[model samples]
Each structure stands twice: as C-alpha cells, then as structure tokens.
Target: MEEGKICRTNPESSDQVKAVHMLLVSYPLQGHITPFIKLAYLIAGRGIMATLVITEFAHARMIASEPDLGNERNKVRYITVPDGLSEDERNDDVKLSQSISEVMPGHLREVIEKVNMEGNQVTCVIADPMFGWAFEIAETMKLKLAIFWTSAPGVLALILSIPKLIEDGIIDTKGSSKLDGKIQLSPDLPPLTSADFLWNYSGNQTPAEIMFQYFFGIHQNLKRSGWLLCNWFHELNPLVGNLVPNMFPVGPLLASGKPAANLWPEDLTCLSWLNKQPAGSVIYVAFGSITVLSQHQMDELALGLELVGRPFLWVKRSDLIKGGSSKYPDGYEERVANRGKIVQWAPQEQVLAHPSIACFLTHCGWNSTMDGLSMGVPFLCWPYFADQFYNRSCICNGYKVGLALSPDEYGIVTRHEIRRKLDSLVADDGIKVNALKLKDMAHRSISEGGFSARYLDNFIQQMKE
Candidate 1:
C-alpha cells in the first residue's frame, strides 16, 4: 500500500492503500471544536475514516448549526457522549473545566467500546490535550494516541518550560499574574518579555503555581501521545519547527476555496455588498464566536469604523453584548449607513478571499489570524486574552503582517486610536505587498503538492502501517 494516499475497496484493482480509522475528540469549547472538525473534513476527504466525538451540548450545536454533517450517518460520523451534568447544570457562563476532565473520559470509553463491538476497529485516538484522561484510555485499549494542542508550538514551548522555571525559583506563587521582570528565553527563541510568556493563570491558584501544575500534567501526557498535531504552518513558525521536528504543522486548515457554511443564520447578502466595492478596499472584522464586548466598547468600535471611512463588514452576534439589544449605540447603524455592513454571522473564508478585503480588524484569535494570512490580509490586532496575545505578537512582530492596538485601562479601544492604526496599516503599500506575498505562500503550503498536504499523508501512512 502506498503511504498517505486514499484508496478504495476494489477486488479487481491492486493499488489500494490501507485506510486509517481515526477517532477524533475535541474539547467542548466552540473555538477548539470548529478547527478540529475542519481538519477531520480534510482527513475524510482523503479517504481516511474519521469519527468525531463531541459532548452532548457541543453535538447539539454542531447539528443545529450545520445539519448537512448528518451525525453518525455521513462519511465522518458524529458521536455525542454524556456530559455528566443535568440539563439545568449546563450554563453558558459557568466554568466547564471540571466536567471535561472528570466526567467526559468515562462516557468516551463506553462509546469507544461500543464502536469496537460494532466492528469499527479504532486505529488511533486523536483527542484534545485538555481532555487528559484520553491518554489513559488509549493506553488501556493499546491504540496509538495522538493529542492535538489547538495552540501554537511557541505557546506549547512556553507551557512546557514552566516546570523548569519553577524549579529554578524564577517564578513561584507569590508574584503578580504577569512576570514583573524581563527574562531571556532560549537562545534561539525570539525574545519575549515576561508578560508575553505568561498564560492566563486566572483561576483560583496563584500564577506561578497554576503554570507549575498545568505544565506538569501536560508533560506527562506529552510523552504518551504517538504524535502531536498543531494548528500552525512552517511559514509562520520555522524557528519552532527546527526545535521540534516531530511536531506536525498541518494547518491554517481553513477553507481553500469558498467553504460551505458550517453554521446557519449565514447572511449571504454581504457578498453582493462586496461586489460593489473596489479591489482590496474593504475591512473584514469579526471577533470570533466566544468573545463578548461591552456595549460601550461596541459603540467605540462603531465610531472607530465611522472615523476610518473605509468600507467595512462587522459581524455582530445578537448575544454578544452582556445586556440586551438596548445596549447598542443610539443611531449607530444609521450613522454608518452606506459605507459599512453588519451581519449576525458571516461566511468568513469567502469574505477573506474576496478581492475587496483590504484589512482584517481582528481580536487576534489564532483561527482568524490564520484565515486572514491564508488570504493575505493585513491586521489591526486587538488581542483579548489567552494565547491571543501571543498570536498578536507573532503577526505584528514576527510576520510584519499587522499593527497592534493597546486597549485602555478599562479594555476599551477608542475611536481615535482605531482611526490612526487603520490608516497606518492600510496605507503602507510595501506592507500590503508583503502581506499578499505571505498569503500566496500560505496558500501554496496547503495545496495538493505542498508540505502540509504531504505531512497529512505521512501521518496517515504511519498510522496505517
């Protein structure tokens, strides 16, 4: 059997490659699950059989959002395991950290056993690293286990280094959440201030202690997984690649061409709006599904767009602001009438690919940044939290593809600052050209004959063998 190539069951033909059966599990968060599903689609498209497992709550959203997925009936089946929480117990605002760790693994094991009983041999278990218990399950079943870290390799390196730093007594429980002093990382790594290296250790534990415990658990499982899949590409992080050759960079796994809508309430009318704009003239802004903006911040953003005077499309989810619709600025929509377009949810890939998209005003979420880079759009980076700060640093510092904006003490991005940064990021023709060049490079990396495509083939080949 040829490696990583898709094959069919034809008795008459002798060119069949062994099909790898994969069980993919994602954490319950929307941001994490979405990317894994896209990767599963890529794998399934290559003739590998992939079963995607999600929590019951997440499964409902998937089915409700994209019915075409056809749970358990499609080429990629969807299985929903019990969340070990009552209907009332599942609240959107509360912490789900414990349920995923303590409850999910048992339900997941039962599902694995059931599938095995039904003659579906699970060749490998691919799970999110946050679901740490999966490592134990895979070991028990003697299946090859691969863990996916939905964060970047650079972030992972920082995560893995915490234990060593703790042992050296450089960081401990008594300090501030962010490091007080600047420290040099490894010689090869790009110098990041201590603040830049800090993760959001915001739960009950002290900052240093939190990082200590988190990294300790992660390192133990890191050794168990046969492979690690990261949502990064070589062009973005060649330095990290040199450090960890075994780590697979199979992404920016966004829609190559226009992808079909994964969730509903997609407003296709925005495409028509794009047609009227000149080439590379519109700013595409979306803060992703989870991040919420205060009503005041939303108003400031609106005014900021109005101040910039660029044609723009902003995705405004109805549930975004904490309060109700009353929070929206009075006469804000009417004020930006002809120049701006606002929709609830959008077909993001199509928007990014459009010739009219000049820049992306983003929250610096990894997926959005990758998508923007895939299409060659420069960014106005407003990093919210968790690895997003690191992602912003990568683009603005490492890639020269963006301009960063600092929010106020209250975390509000004022209109004046927005206007200034937008002008600077969009006006530089050389930066624009560089961004386009990077975009083309990113596209090529994911194409059929590219490095990322080959890596996908290699991983599958290893599994089948």
Candidate 2:
C-alpha cells in the first residue's frame, strides 16, 4: 500500500488532510457502478473522504441524474477517464466483458497522476474485479488496493476453483463434456454440473478460457490488495466466507438502516402495486442491465408468469429485446396486463424490500442477487451468463436460499418449468421462513457491530498501516 501524495507545503496545512481517502473504481457498467456508488456513499457518510472514478460518459449521467451526492458533485467526487470508445460504442450494444477488455489503461494512469497533483491524497482504492488494470494503478500510486468482487462469495469460490479444474484436466479451450452429468467439486458446495462454470455469452473468451483468465487474474491481484470485500453477509454465505478468511462480507449496503438515499428516480412505481398484494404474494423479476433476452424466451417467460398466476413485476429494458422492436409478439403486453407490471426498470431496492415480494426471478447478477438476499427474499435463479450459473447453483443448493430453473437443451425454459418452480418456491411454507431468517442475518451483517462491520473496520486499519 502507498502513502498519500503531499499537497500542502505549509506544515500547518498538513493537519487538514483527511486520514481516510478512498478512490473507488467500478467497471463502468450500470450493474457494477450503482452498488459501488452506494458503498462509497456509506463510506463517505461515515466520515471517510471518497471519490468515485467514472468514464467520461458515465460522469455526465451521474451529474445529470444524481446532483446532490457530494458537495463536489454528489457527496462522491468524480474523475472522468477516456474509455477508448467512440460515442457509438458507448451505448449498451457492446458486450460487458468485451468492453472491459478493450478499455485503455492510459486514462486510469492519468486519473491517478491528476489525483496526486490535486493533493486530496487517496489512501486506498476499491476496484471492481472486472476493471483489470486497477492493480497496476495501485502499484503505480503505491496505494493499498482492495478488490471488490461485487458478486456473492459462492461465485468467488466457484471462480477460484477454475485453476484447480484446469489442473485436473476437466476444462479446456473448447469446454468439457464433464458437465453432462451431476458433479460435486466442493464437499460443502451445492452439487453443480460442469455447465455451471461455462462462460456462456461473454464475448472476450470462450467459456473455459474466460473462467481460467478471470480466476487467474483474481488470484494474482488478491496478493497485492489490503483485503478483499464481498457484497454478501455471513448468514448468507457462512461456510464459503469462513473458508476464505481474508475476504470480508460487508454489504447488503442498500437502504442500510441509515435512511433512504434516492439517487436514482423511482421509475415503474411498482411499489404501489406491491402494497396492494398480500405479504409474500408476488415474484419480482429483474435480470440486471446487461442481460438480453430473445423474443421466443420473453414470450415463454410471459407464459410462465401467467401460468404461475401470481402478481409479478418484471423489468423489460428497451434493449432487452434481442432483435429490437419486433421481439414483442402481438398483444404480448395486453395478455399479461392484468397480473404483471411491465416496466422499463424498477426501483430495485424498494421493490425487494416490499413485504409483498416473495421470491426473486433473477439472472444472478451479483448486485441484484445480493439485494434480494439482503431483504431475505428467496430466488428463482435464471442465470444468463459468466458466473451467474455458478451463483444460481450456490443459492439453490449451497445455502438452500433459492431454486434453479432448468431449461431445455437449447437453454430455453418453458412456461411449465417456470410455473412448477414458482409454485414450489412461493407455496412452500419453509421458503418464507428461510427467507425471513436470511433477511435478519443480512441486516445483522451490515449493522453497527456485525461481522461485516468489523471486517470493514479492520480493512481500513490495514490501509492505515
């Protein structure tokens, strides 16, 4: 870890420097950026000086949407870096992993040099796992860099196993046929087939190559950091977290007992509809910002929710349709108008917190899954890509907190399977009891004296050391 850059020439002015200054770097994608911002708010609100680094494009969106975050801008100051992407490439069209791989390292170095020159002096950097060059930036600045997986511990464990899988000759560039049947890699982890580790849709590398490179990068980076932080709590991943001791489970940080911070506007207004339903009466579905669905899949999904007959809130982003406007079948919205609330996006935290949200229908993106678990809502996992399938298995089997949706050979799930899982999850009395129990534990982890709280305290202390 590196010490701060000296800004004040006057000895008297040296006293003005804040002891804890953090430069928070995220993967620039919406799913990755929002949670990191929330965590930065929690840290800044607690008296630490924090600055959030964003790409030139995201910087504009933040100021326009969330102006009051910092006195500097939104409580979290901004540093704009060039993404090496043109305006056309900046849209949601590019794949996330591909976008990350293509990002230039020059802007990140420039941001560090500029920060050192400005003299605010960063003590440590919290870097997203996907932002691969952050370790190099930390090395250059000599600052302690901590990696935030932004995913669950179970996913981390599965990713960590990639190196071992390669050594065992179970995976290769083309992928393995070993996943054709049930397999148990970890004694304590859920029974997962090889498909769980498959990279599926990430554009940069094949499934096997992606898993190998991602984990290889993660392990090497961990040795350089002050400590690692996960957005999960002990109650949700006690077994895995304990196995990986240096990793801290410090989150479920949204709407954390402090007070509601409405950074993003409440679109969709699904809460009003949630209020009208009975406790645990609805299934909330959101696959996060990047997961796109085909027209056939969406229609099947609609038929599934309709078959379940439970009230539901589903986020259908403008880009969600793969072939664009033609994806929505004739009268699709009208067909589910009575039971489903179809919105572009919903206030996720509020929707999850609502008592009516019984189960979450998700793609297992780290942030969304953590939010749902933090509220103690069980899941119906429909993982789209990357480590999501691994995460889905972890939730469904590792912790028994959710159920997995098994699709057909083409990876397309039918309405019958969806309805079967939904009824089994929401109707079972044990699921609700388990959900409430998990929720209580999640709250405790983020509370003042909880495990995650203590872990965060120790992590900061290491940076000071």
Candidate 3:
C-alpha cells in the first residue's frame, strides 16, 4: 500500500495487489495516440495503474470530440502537457519536432516526480521512440525506460538498416536516396524502394536535413532503450525478430469496451447505414488522418466509386483535398446518393467489424491496416506516404490479402485503376480466404496464452520486478 512496493503472497494469505504504475508518452498525433491508449487499457486490465500523457493541443481536441474521455469508469488516467507550439504550427512536422524537443522534457520530468510524490511511484516510462528525449529524463529519474514502436515491424527493421543502407551506397548520410530501385532487407520480408524511406515523404514541406537528423536521432535512442515494444504480433513479420532481437511484439492493440480515443468526432450514423446493407457487399474507405489528396485524384476516386456501384461508406475529412475545398465531380453525389454514405469521420473499428463490409480502400496507415487485417477484410491499397508504401507491400505481396492500385505516369491513381483494383480484389476468392486466415491468426495472437499475450505478460512482469 506504499509507493514503490508490491504485495507478495505468503503462507498465511494470498491477495491480488497493484504491481506497477506506468506512464505512457506518445507523440501528439492520432496514429501514435491510438495505440498508446490501447496499450494503457491493456496494462490496466492486468491490474497495473496506467497514465497516458499527451500534448495540450491534442488533449483539447480529444476532450472536445469525446466529452466523456476522462470519466472515472476509464481505467487509465490522462494528463496533458504544453507542447510549446500554436495549433497551426503543430501541422508542420519539423516545427512540431523542434518544439517537442525544446519544451516537453521538463514538463515530462515534472509529471513523473509529481506522480511519485502522490503515492503512485512511477515505475517505468514507456514512450514512442520519436520522443527520444524521454530516455534521458527517465534515466535521470532512475526509472526503467521502454520504447514503443507504433508502426509495422518492417518499418523498424528499415530504420535499423539505415547504417547498412548508407554503407551500401543506397542512401546518403543525410537520408537522401541515391538509387531509385527495389531493395530487400530480408528474403522473408517484402521488397521496398527508395521512395519508402521514412524521412523522404515530406518532399520539400520540411527541410531534408532537419528531417534526416530527427529520424537519425530516433534511431540512436532506440538502440539505447532498455526494452523495445512494437504494436504488431510475431507472425506478421517474424523475420524482424531476427533483425532487431530486442523487439517485443504485443499488439494489434485495438480498443475495446470504451469509446475510442479519437481526435475527431465519429459519425455513428454510418453504423446504422452499414446494418442496412447486405453482408459482404459494401466498400469501407478511409485514408487515415493526414493524407491529403489532389483534386484530380479526388475526382477520379469519386467517379470510380460510382462506377463500382456498390454500397459504400467513405470518410471524407474536411481537409482531405489539398490546397482547396474537397470537391467531387459534377452531380456525382446525386448519382450515388441512394447507395453511398459520406461523413467527416466514422467509428472505423465498428465499421470494419460489420459483416456487411467487403473490402478496405485505404491509405495503408499502420493502424488502418491492422484494423482491416484483424477484421478479415481484403484491401485495395492506396498508400499516401511515409512507411505506407512499405505497409502496402506487406498487405499485397507478403500476405497476399490485398491488391495495389497502380498510378499513371503523371502520378495519379486513375479512376479506371480504382475500379479495376476493386473488381480484382472482390472477385479473387484466394485473397478473401487469406484475409480470413490472417484474421484468425491476429485474433489468436492476442487471446489468452497466445504469443502476444505471453509477451505482454512477460513485459508486465518485468515492470513489476
């Protein structure tokens, strides 16, 4: 019943006692926050007290979207720290990274010390490796520090291979790709190209040198982390274990029983619409939080969906189109009004789990990919940037449960291509079968006594010690 103490069973009595209290810190992005929240719930389910810390800007959006977020019924406690940036400035990756480095460390240290003084001794800090500074703070406090990889194991593997890639003359020290060909990190993994380099996606939006140093710093911190936790199961990328031996896979960390910790308000009306559709007869389309489409591409996609003539639910975020309003082809809405449903956002997990959902047309963000995969939905991949192209390779080539949409010389995925890919994805019985098999494996990995469950238990036990 005291700080830094756990109950032990004796000959006279046996009792369940709180073993540890963990503080989870994530980069204030939707993709990163989603998994950290899930992991918090997972830890609390094991009788450990969990606290999740986020930037004040993200916290405000979350509270506005989900007013009941911090209710007492929730097992995890939530905290917010000033990120030292305006809401608009946070949209730029380089500015966000700079502000976080300059501002968040002292605040995080205060949080840990305050929590310790309040009788819940902070046992460990599990953080997104992107926040490399947390490692130093945890070290100063003499607490165990672990890094959580929020993306695919393959992405981590690719980051781990940066030195080798530079040695092989595939990339420069500044993270620029010297060659534009395919590469295979391991025979067991999917092949990638220079375009998939994590830092190369911004394309002049952020200075190359700044982005390069940011990612390189993260890579260095990952090597120094006491433990590495990834949000994927072993079966998904078994070869990554051989590549990064310290990595622990304890996920597909999806939320259950509580409202999702989403930054945007979800349109629950879509669920009722999904119920009206026939089983396996609807397309579920969403491109995560950050993908911005070109007007040409948006027009083409709208027409393609009309061509498919299937009942579809699409998440058309207000910021979906770049540099302008999100506008579709003339009368496109009226033409498909009877069968199509469009909303600013939807409860993605519930929509995917619905029996009426057929396949996912996705930007291939890791969280969206896992959601679709775990639900047994086949995919029509339209990766936007960052490691998304690599995730697409895993979905299409490594797992054989998805099909990639081809882009033309002008760099647009044409309307015809979308229609064709969807047709192929739906007609292929093999892909459907593989998708269900993958779903079963995902479910089993997270179940009791399963691979991920055992790894999670080991992680919790280590924290307890």
Candidate 4:
C-alpha cells in the first residue's frame, strides 16, 4: 500500500468494469462520513470503481490514520475538497452543516468531470441527503443518483411526512411540530408526538432556522430521486422503507476491513482496561461527538457513575462542561480511582464489542444505535437532540431492547435515577434477550441471501445499469 494519489484498481480494464463507477458524497460530519466510507469500501471491494468525496479536514485526518484506503484490489479513491470552513468553525455544528451543504456541490461536480476527462465514467452519485444541492447538480448532469439517507428508515418516513403534516394542519408552513400528544405514523408503528420531530427547533435561532430550511430542501429535492438507499435493514423498520417507493434497505453497514473514518485518536489502551474486568461487567458510556452536556448535568453524571460503583469506561469530551471547567468534585477521581476510566474518546465499535461491556449508556445516534444493536448490548437510552429521540423510541418502544432514563424536573437525570436505570439494565434479562436476537438478525442480514446482502446487490446492480 502506498499513498500519494488515489488510483483505479488496475491499469487494464474491460468495458463492463468501466461501466460502473460511483461517487459517494456525504456531509462533513462524523456520523455521515463514517458509514459512507464503509459503503465505499464495500462497493469497491465488489469490483466497482468507487470514490468517496469528503472535506479536506476529514480526508487529511483519515489518510494519515488509516492504511486500508491505500491497500490493493479493494481500494477506494479519495477526493478531497474544501469544506468552506476553518479549524475553529469545524466544531460549530450549525455552521459546518450549512457550509458543507453550500460548498460540496461544486467540488463534487469537479470530481465528476475529472473522472470523465480520465476516460472513465462516473455513472452515479450516492449522496447523503443532508446536502440537497447534490440533487440539483446530479439532475443537471443527468447522472443516476440515489439519496443515501444515513438515518433510520423511520426518520426518513418522518421527513417524507412533512407535506402531509402541513396539509393536514398538524403543523404550519414553518417546520414547527404542534401536537398535544403522540400520533400514529402507521398502524404497525408506535405513536409519535411533537417531540420526535428531527429538527424541532424553537423560534428565531439562526442555526435552527438554517437546519429547518435544510430539511425542507431535502424534502423538495428528493422528490426527483428515483432511488432511496437507507443505511438500515428490513428487520429494523420494514414499514418506513416499504411505504416509500424505490426504497432499498441496505445496511447495518458494519465496518469489516477498512476502518471507517475516525477523527479522534482512539485510545486502544481501553482494550487492556476491559481485559482486567469480569465478563459483562463494565458500563460503556459514550455520547457521540457534538453532544455537549451542561455543567450541572455533567456533575450529576459523575456522581451517578460513582454511585453505580461499577467498572466503567466513559468517553468524556473536553468541552462537555458548559463553563469550560472540570465538573468533578475534589477527590472524586481518587475516590473512584479503580472504578472508572475516563478518556476524551475510545474506539467505540471495539468498546461495544468487548466482552466485559455489560450496558451502553448511549446518545442514541444512528451509528451508536446500530453498533449497540449489532453487538447485542442492552442500552440505556439518553438522547440529547434531533433524530436521537426517535431512535430512542425505536429502541425502547419499538424493539423493546432498551430502557429510557427519566430526567428530573430540570431535565437532568438525578444520581439516584441513573443508579436505578443501571440496576434495571443489569438485572433485566428480557431486554438482553431481545438485544441478542436483534444482533443475530443484524448478522444474518449481511450473510448470503439475507436482507442487506440482497438489497445491497440490487443497489450495486442498479449502479451498473
């Protein structure tokens, strides 16, 4: 494996091999980028020429860290482009999403044209639907395009229901979801309320305004898209994907060979930490990057973890505290010295897969949900925002594989409450049983003739056609 320029697999080619080339463009965020890179690796390994287009920051970081992208035969070409952002603005979630949506289209078009100039054809654009501008560019170029929605199928169903919601007067022209209580999206599904709306933004914040507009734009642009590739399976949300036409449920897109884009340096030291613990004993606590807990919330969490009095590995971001100060009380670490390992980040997939990890206190992000599901870990769902609430609903209400934490009046999970949930998660065998069954179904989906395998095959074949 060598690094300098990305290359096609072989110099010699046939017309058939040249016929199928794909360009995958995801939003410049960890959640969107990781799975698409995994999808790129999968597509390329299946003997198609696939290029993963990412922001310059992500491209540089991943290239320096991962060797799999440079390996032979199953190689994916990397197209690095300006994110129209800076080092500082990268952490500003609102601006980053807006910027990626604005800048990526021109950069992506350049890659498409460059590939054409090289005498190879780029037949399709598999884009993360967050950036709807890709829909316009691909339409103008007349390239076959698929909306690679990275969230759950149920989330997609919610997005698609916007027009109907407006028409039914359940909501207004603005994206404000107004309802007194839960309403059924379908007969088979559980009820949803105003709370489960993906971008249930309060009034007049610019970022929230921008995000609402982004979702509306996605709704409009996706109308022209003939193919919708969901990064989930039929087992998860059979109704959501099937209700919508040309929907291909093709995932649980697990990392197999090439490690998907990891921005944070994973502390592999955690593996050794797990080895010392008894099987199914350590609590794996990680909220995905971008979730910031308030200072009080952070303080309460620390007290709660100590109260659990169990071995735990907690991934704590430096900016987790609101006032930018340590939330832990004096002598806290010494008191729980051998009981916990708190780092800035850990290799989450590996941590979730570890035998000693008994329960996962997760943010309920799509990737985290999938990782927990695939690994058969019982979940303690504590969602902060966005699709997470819905994902939590799916976990706790839909699948019955998790327990939801009840927050106090001030929206904080009190120490005693955390302890109780942890106790329930540890004591409950039914949830664990369901989690294991879901894990087996997830594994079987990627096996021969399984749901993911068949649909993924269909999707790639559509790319060729």
Superposing all C-alpha atoms, what RMSD in Å does each candidate have to the true structure? 5.1, 5.0, 4.5, 2.8
Give the clashing residue pairs of candidate 3, or none.
none
Candidate 1's C-alpha lDDT? 0.73
Candidate that scores best on lDDT? 3
TM-score per candidate, in order?
0.88, 0.85, 0.93, 0.93
**lDDT per residue (tens digit) for residues 1-465 in model 4:** 222134434442667658888888877777888889778876766777778777778877766656455565556777678888878998777788778778777777787887788877888888877667887788899899898888876677777888888898887777776678877776546678886776674322456545666778778766778998877778876667656888887778877635668767667788898999999999999998767887778878888999998999999977777567566877888988887999887878788888999999998999899989989999999987688888888899888999999998878899899999999998999999999999999989978899988998898887776
| Candidate 2 TM-score versus the reference | 0.85
- Residue-level lDDT tens digits of model 2 in 1-465: 012222112121233236667888877777777778777766765656667776666655655544444344234565666566667766644454566556646666666677666676777889987566878878777887888877666567765666666676666544443455665654666766665654543433345554556566766666566577878776665667544557877787784422222323346468788888888788898888777778888889888998888888987777787768635557767877877887777778888888888889999988777787778888999987677877787777666788889989987899899999999998777766777787788788778899878877777777667
Best by TM-score: 3
lDDT of 2 at 454: 82
List the global CA lDDT of all models: 0.73, 0.70, 0.84, 0.80
Better of 2 and 4 by lDDT: 4
Q: In terms of lDDT, which candidate is stronger, 1 or 3? A: 3
What TM-score should be assigned to candidate 3?
0.93
Counted clashes in each candidate structure: 0, 6, 0, 0
- Summed over model 4, clashes come to 0
Model 3, residue 422: distance off in Å is 0.8
Q: Give one digit per residue, the lDDT tens place, for model 1 in 325-373.
A: 6354688778888899989888888899899999998888877887888
